[model samples]
Target chain A: MMPLWVGPVARYMATGLVTTLALAVVSIAVSVVLGTLLGALLVLPSRAVRLAVRCYVEIWRGLPIIVTLFFIFFVLPVIGLRFDTFVAAAIGLCLWGSANVAEVVRGAVQSVPRGQADAAAALGFPWRQRMRYVVFPQAVRRAVPPLVGLVVNLTQQTSLATVIGVLDLLQASQRSIERLTLSSGATHAVPILGAVLVVYFVICLPLTSLSRRLERSLQRA
Target chain B: MTAVDFEPGFVFSHLGPLGQGLARTLAISAVGTAGALAVGGLLGAASALRIPVVRQVIGAYVEVFRNTPLLVQIFFLYFALPEAGVKLSAFTVGWLSLVLWGGAYNAENFRAGFEAVDPKYVEACRALGFSELASFRRVVLPLGTRTALPSVTNTLISVFKNSSFMIAIGYPELTDTAVDIVSVTFRAFEVFIAIGVVYLGLVWIFSLGAGLIERRFAIPGGH
Candidate 1:
């Protein structure tokens, strides 16, 4: 039979994966909506609004995600807005993800041919109509591959939530190893750690390859 | 919500250790970036040359590092290695992990740079009878490095930011110093903000330096 720790450890890791997935899903959703809006705002006619958005992106992008996590986890509590550790992690990831996604979104939108915009203008299309009919479709097509890549990054980053006590897969493995060591004599740490590594490797490796393939095919088109 | 009281003097008072911490952060970043560039340069060159085993090895390295969380990599180094009879200090493990991780990303960036070199240029070099190594050194490396500059700068900044993760493994870096101060004074806001300012300063300075290098090496009409 397999080692006794296998079943429980698998269950524990599964739970951790759930948390990781939930965190990524919620954060990605929030980031996509907010990022797309902020990206649109980056090209706004109003100088002050564009300036404010630029600073926001620069600050978040410049700071480490861990520091952002720490700030939200620790500082928000001081101001009477306490969040669960997972919630804090999600919010932190959201901030960093949105900043980066905003940049990607802006780049994608800007890369759409200016001629298209000029043609739309010459045809008397308003800004909203032009964005809806002429611009967003192409930008979204251009954005999908990079956006998927960003999600993969966010998935990897959810592991950082372990530092803030989120009991992620890494933390689960750490806890299992400690527990096994205490309960049974002379437990090896490698197998357990290797299992956790394999789990991450399995999830992430394919996504990255897929992203590269998409990028290549997009270039071809 | 009542506004948290504005506090400036706390961080100012602890500037000495924090300054030391900032220095350590910079040291790690500089050393890590250098190591990454060295490893990545070799791997990228090998890849561009289509070396048999090296390409596969680099592919594995890039995928593994890119896919996994840096925190787990750090932990495996810090925790697992000791069990395997390789005792490494938290600082050494932290530094090594950053170098390894940065190298993988750097390799991809460099490979992209290498691929960006036009085929016609290589053909022209061949027509001049320059040896492969000679032509690569004379033409490819400079062009690749220039093409790779922006991405490499971004990677360097990320490696520096990632040095903060070392705080989890007990490195006496800037974020750790800030955590220490916050614990003692219960002033999380001021402490983190102070450290953030230093981080911002470091990033800005490095960006300025990168911009200078970019200008110095910029080829006319080169992207």
Candidate 2:
């Protein structure tokens, strides 16, 4: 049987879908920049910088996403660090994605041939210019496929943001259930949840397939 | 509302009650991960057999699990399924949700592991007249397990961390405990910090164990 929650199903799905996309895009943008920098510094000549970055990534990655969400959402306000739900969620996700992305970036960057760095050095090119022209370009190319996969994962992680009342997709579904149950004493879980799943599939399928294809194409090349 | 006072013993005292929740979290995570391994392994094995029917079914399972968020899965199972004569205890829904969700992802890992095993080993085993089971156990497994170690560990870490989704379904895990403490004591910072610290400790311990496993099955970096 179709859900009675069908009344608000479209509205809930549309709201949740847009919120998910916003979270994914903002989180990805923040993390990619921070991750790239963190990764580069981790490979820097200075031991302390590498060690510090390593610790930061390790600390963030080791904690559960929910714990991070709670820490940012609840704890921040205690110390006078207030944020709206969106900002809090975005920061939590950015921190988590950055840790993983940094590792991915470092792995890709290190995979680039040492000879390229040697050639750059022989030409008296400064390190920044060489990394920009010679190294980062190749690393970035190799990193794109995996980074795409990371973004897909991050999209799913945004569901955690609802804990702090962001009213994202999951929350929207829950609200529909609550309202419907209260009004009619009947819940339309099937259609409501089914609709939510369909939305996610439509959003995620392309990215997932693209990454897989890129992995194959990259391997062949 | 006046922010509640940060009395010292009250927060610490709640730890006694909170231990039950923490234990539940650990148990749920362990059960969920074990269920994922079994379900994922079967699906992976079936899909890898190249049977069209099994492949199609497993593909759909993977799609449903992979595309949606775990929180939604838990909520659907916990809150919605009851109306359909598929009632579950909160704990049951929590564990089953993770099993269903994590199984899909882990199946992909297993399939990848199955694919990367050397063909020559299987050919040699076949030439020697070993049973398929024997060959899979002796040859394909050793190599595939090594290749799969890093990804498996990665999934394990995820399964452990994702355990916190139980909060949505009201399973009363660490995250929920932190919230409760914050509500009661108004020491949001301390409570949240404590929650993060505990999760970090647990995950660190898990990583240490995984690192040891990875080291045991060290392979060439080419893959």
Candidate 3:
């Protein structure tokens, strides 16, 4: 049988769930747009630009997400640029997600057959036109599977926002557990945490399976 | 901001402690990678063997670990495990969690590698009088390991990065050391940036090492 506070805890987690969803959506949107641009730039003619973008990607990817979260939430204030906890968490996730998305974009774009681009150029299409008409159509199809995988990853990563003091799902659960224990005089971490874990499993399991299925289908294609 | 505002000297001042932290990070990552590889190898083999129950279990593990945030897993072990009368040191818990998490991903990588081994080559091994286990150990493992190198490298880099999550449990790894220095010096920007650079350097070195291993294992014109 569930505890009396289960109802209250569910209510509490609902709010946290909302926060998590919002964080994931905002971060995913920002990263997708910026990362796509960065990915496009990665294949540009200028070696210097490509090198610089590569460095950016490596730096963001190399640092731990937690470190990046701390850098944004804690370090930025020193430079006189401060953001709220949610904003800081979003920026950190965006930076990390964008770097990964950029790599996916670069890989997908490059994977497009070279002949298509050459033919487009022969037809007097400019670089942008070639990407728009000839390259992206094929590249985007290839990009979808990995991008879906990355977005799923970003969704899961929204949990890290708790570290930055965001009242996301995990943080809300912790707070609820503290309150419930204090009021009801029972230690019930396992059940509550188990429930929380299951919630994550529900939210993410489908997406992960979808990602794998997509990857398999992409391979077949 | 002025040029002097971003001082490189801050990093130099904290080099001793940071170096110690970096060493710990390296130790954790190395041990974690070794543990992951061991577990991943077994799980990968199990999955590839297609024993229904074993495959289902490994599939569950891969999905769970791949789906959830590493932070939650760390928290569950660090906070929840004590309630069940298993009081592990923060370092031990962190190390084990890394192995558990990284192993799941590595298992998938290894499974893919194992499955990618050409059937013809495996048949040739059997025809050459190698037993099933012997064929797998001699033929499947080497080829699978080679095939899995790139994914394994990616997983290792992630394991190294995830090691920073040990800070949540108060373990004094590189990120934690950076946090400590910043609290002492109020120079969060400089200290954290320096730590980021350290991580970047470590990842670069790790990738280079993996590249060398991949080359060494390269199958004569068949990369």
Candidate 4:
């Protein structure tokens, strides 16, 4: 049979899980779109643009995600840019996630053989058509596995929103532990946090395995 | 509310605490890297040797740790373990989590390296009548470690970066130090930017050192 705390804790955590999913979904979607743009810009002929994109990617990716979130949530208000906790966390995550995805995209695009681009040029295709018809399709195949890995990482990282008090899965479990301990006078951290761990494991393990499988197949190809 | 003026130099005035925090971060990262290497090396070698149930156990360990976030693992170690009567200090929990997480990734890195060791070398060692242990120590160890160096270096850098997560449980690392200063001074921009630069510098130095070692130990005529 189930314990009394199970029902209440699950109910509380379900709401938190929804928030976590929303944050992850928004961050992932925005980052992928922005990062792909930054990545394409990284390969442009203009040295200044490439350098600017490089700095953005390096700076954001180098900082800890927590610091990024804190800077957004805590510091931005000092400069008159106020954001809600959820919005702040989402923006912070997008900055960091996009930087990582940008690197992956850059690497994937560069990995495509130079000969592919030259062949398209030889066929009298313009630069846009060459990249559109020839390069991106091949690059997309190479990029998929790493992109999936990034999604896994971004999902796991959404838990960090708890630090900024975003009521994520981890935060909800913390609240549950507190309420249960207060009422029952015994630590219920194990079951609640254990459930939290299981939740994350369930969400991430399949993606991780899928990424590995894709990587293996890519290597064989 | 009145406009909050940006004080870009505010963090510079509190260099003492930030320096202490830097030391703590470096110390924890150093110790964690060593522990991770030891644990990962052993587990990876065991997996390479294919020791019955041990291999499966190591596989499971790698998957579970890799699949979960480092933050949650830290919470489990800090918050959950105490319920089982295994109370540990926050500092203990900080580096322990890094070691555990980094060790898992490193195990996978080392296993791939060991598996990539060309079989002809093993055959050559065997034809010379060397025992399994000696051959592993002599030939496979050197070559495998070379192949593993790139990925292992990545995990090591991640260990340094992840030490920032210690702030959640208040371990007084660099991020924690910055947070404390921010609370008192309200100079979030300066504090976060300063610490971000520090972390980037640390990562840069680490990668540079790793690159040097990679060059020094590079296998002749092998990519």
lDDT of 1: 0.87
Candidate 4 residue spans exceeding 4 A from truth: B1-4
Quality of candidate 2 docking, DockQ: 0.59
Q: What are the Cα lDDT values of the candidates?
A: 0.87, 0.82, 0.87, 0.91
DockQ of each: 0.73, 0.59, 0.63, 0.73
Top candidate, metric DockQ: 1
Q: What CAPRI grade goes to candidate 4?
A: medium
TM-score of chain A of 3: 0.93
Which candidate number has the best lDDT? 4
Question: Per-residue lDDT tens digits of candidate 2, residues B1-223?
Answer: 4564565455576787578778888888899889888887777777765678889989988987888778878877877688788889888887788788878988888878877887888889999999877888787767776777778778877888888888877777777777777777677765766667778888888889999988877876744
Global fold similarity of model 2 (TM-score): 0.92
Which model is ahead, 2 or 3, in terms of DockQ?
3
Kindly state the number of residue pairs that clash in model 3. 0
Candidate 3 CA-lDDT value: 0.87
Model 2 captures what fraction of native contacts?
Answer: 0.72
- Locate the minimum summed-lDDT window of 10 residues in model 4 chain A: A74-83
Docking band of candidate 1: medium
Q: Where is model 3 more than 4 Å wrong at Cα? A: A119-126, B1-4, B127-129
Root-mean-square deviation of every model: 1.6, 2.8, 2.1, 1.8
DockQ of 3: 0.63
Winner on DockQ between 2 and 4 is 4
2 or 3, greater by TM-score: 3
